[model samples]
Target chain A: MTLLIQVQLPDGGWAYILSIIFVSLQVSVTAVGVSTLVSLPVALLVGFTDFPGKRVVTAVINTGMGFPSVVVGLVVLILLSNSGPLGGFDLAFTPQAMMISQFILATPVITSVSLSAVESVEQSVRDAAFAMGGTDADVGLVVIKEARYGIVTAILAGFGRAISEVGSILIVGGNIVFSDGQSYTRTLTTAITVEARQGRYEIGLVLGAILLLLVLGVNGLGSWLRSKGRGERSA
Target chain B: MTLSAATVSVSYGPDTVLNDVSLGVEAGEVVTVVGPSGTGKTTLLRLLGMFRRPDDGTITWNDTDVWGLSETERLAVRRRISMVFQEPSLFNAPVAQNVTYGQRVREPWRERIRKSIRNLVGDRTLSESARDALDTVGLLDKADQNALSLSGGEAQRVAFARALAVDPEIVLLDEPSSNLDPRNTAVLEDAIRRARERGVGVVVATHDMNQAERISDRVGFIYDGKLVETGPPSQIFDTPNDSRTKQFVDGELMYDVEETTNGQARKSTSVSP
Candidate 1:
């Protein structure tokens, strides 16, 4: 005779899941926010000016958009490891390390998309701004305003990328859960991986569904904003 | 005040778009440059508007050489001059916002920041000049509507309002009514007259001889990258000095030259069908 048994969540149970969700949200939002602050100005500079090696810089950004997350994970792991160059701060296997990893993954995605959006604004628009006696800085503001929708879409895309990613964050975060079964750094994506590997298919499916809903909502909002941008431009 | 282009020239690679062009518009005067297409009228207007530095010679605001000024000074000078392109190129915003754009740019940064804070708290944002300019174009009712939602005529009027809202001393118009219907054209001409009456100098570039006759205190005929002649409209239309001006006035000259290879404009005569 054989018996089938269901394994319950360890110690903190539903509270554990909530903690994991909170960690995931905290890491992803911080990463995306920091990346945007760096990426937008870089995008604007690259979008508006003609400089030496611009094509090479643009090519690098495009290549970065498709960079493998696992490779990023490995590189970040080495940098944060105890024996590595940046080992003094002891960031290894911590949420800060995970944020650094996700920021690396999100910056190029935001920059490349935003650069395209800024460049797509019409030359006439810039000319009109200049004709109004706007300085270069003022013209930059006008272009930013004009590209606001596409920039928002780019941010959402970056958020989607940072949130759904499992490899980089997992490698850096170590998917830690404490002795009390309270999550220290485990996220939905990393948790799902461990659950599936441990034969907890039901738990894995729940995490997967939640991740899918988050990504779907983000992408849907992006598409809606993109369409609205097109409509406004055409009008 | 006077805005003048003196012996100005512009070249694009091998092509000479405008050569040895000299024109000036005094306050409260209307000067129209008339020519067939591709004859450098737009290029001359661009130079007068200080949009581009002339390849040779000078643009002057009163006694001051415009191109010789520092960038900040040049921008200050530019704030007092406005140009309307052939296409309206209205922003993707409300009509009132478009009209007030020039004023907003001309404002000091501190004031702009103050207004932004007030705007965040829901204070009124439209300036009196913006409303008055919109009223000038008979589009005050459309102030809240998206600029892009307007018809072509209404859009062009809003463009005019935007240019006027800055209280510019000089206005440069480059074929503004070339794409408009007669009714829209009439409205624009009326606005031009009103601007002149308000003591603003107006420089108009057009290929329409009738429009040149209607709005001009002085008419200039440009051909083959040169100013053929300039005089009162009656003298240009009825008793022109240059044969090219006569041919253009009689509607016989049709310029199809889009490029000037080897620095020579290739003019082609229209064929009778």
Candidate 2:
């Protein structure tokens, strides 16, 4: 019990905690940003257009929404390994590699959810736009505007998934700290794993609390958006 | 300018919606298509509005075949026209925004992008045309209100304002007052009159024969996928060329007995006293 109290703080104190938090925010936010850029357009295309094998593509996205994170980490690890095709980039065990893993983890969630959002827009809105002499692009813009709240909810959901995930980022980031006791790639989730494994329950609990807060914030925003969408629809 | 559908036919599988229907509208005219429901009145308006291509004929805009033109050309031609569907289908936006939707979509791409960015930065000023359209509809005071919050009549009026805001050479309306109270119906009829005074050709499809008599300079009666007869309201209503037109204008019961099956009688689509 005395030892537990003695090591309540991590080796570098508050700066260490702040650094890992910053790293986690940095990596996860960037992954979500890239994922959104890729996912939104894909969702719109898949939702609005007709093509051969569309059902297959949608099924693939739905399948990917629940894809195992550790599997993604393993695939990313192999790709970034020295003997792999991308070995020249030297991204293995780096924050950039972790971002790649998280991005893969997040894209499907955003795409699948955003596709539903886009599809939820009433056909009447598109018809109205067309009746007003809007071109295809203009009609698409109007549909997107109507579906904005749901799309925002989708992005928030993606961010939640990326931030709370531990498996993929841990494998790619390696939870490393610099010699000066600054975090290199260690994130909140991986750091929690490390602290718990090292018998530092106090630090582990603190990291867990921060992660929970972030995830809760994201979920709250999603709930708010859903309600706002419902309210707007009612109006 | 003249918009005309020549020998146009539309089919849904084995069921024909319109067959060899020909109609034309010149600028500064109000041509109302009057008929019972499911008789291809809306289909004719759609063809004239260039919303769909005819299965067997051509739609000519200013003597040029609309379907023969390239898609870009078709879009350019489409900009010269507007349509108001039976459902108002208002956007969940401010009344001013809904009114100006047509004009905004018609802006040049660069201007559209700039305006979108400006809107994002809180530019909520109503455009001159939007203000004029709302004024015409007598809803200028409600410009800032969210369109979804408006009453049914008010929403339909806003839709009329949206169609007029574009200043199209031609406007098509599908059952514009089908579900309105008398006061709201009066406002809509007034707006239609105003649109005609501005030299914009108007085509309205309605089953309300009274509305047809009030607003039309000329009325065409459609029945069973065919243009049964067309003439001045005086001639079509008081004196008629076809027995079907006479039966319809006089409010006589007309039904396709074959359409009834299995103890389920098809309700008469004709407006009755």
What lDDT score is found at residue A39 in candidate 2? 92
Task: Report the lDDT tens digits of candidate 2 across residue range B77-162.
Answer: 99899998888999878788899899888788899889879877988788887888899989999987789988999999999999
Residue-wise lDDT of candidate 1 within B69-109, one digit each (tens)? 99989998999999888879888877887898898888889
Name model 2 segments beyond 4 Å from true.
A1-7, A220-235, B117-122, B252-273
Residue pairs of candidate 2 with colliding backbone atoms: none
TM-score for each prediction? 0.90, 0.91
DockQ of each: 0.51, 0.57
For candidate 2, what is the DockQ?
A: 0.57
- Model 1 stretches with alpha carbons more than 4 Å out: A1-7, A82-85, A88-90, A220-235, B113-125, B257-273
Candidate 1, residue B170: Cα displacement in angstroms equals: 1.2
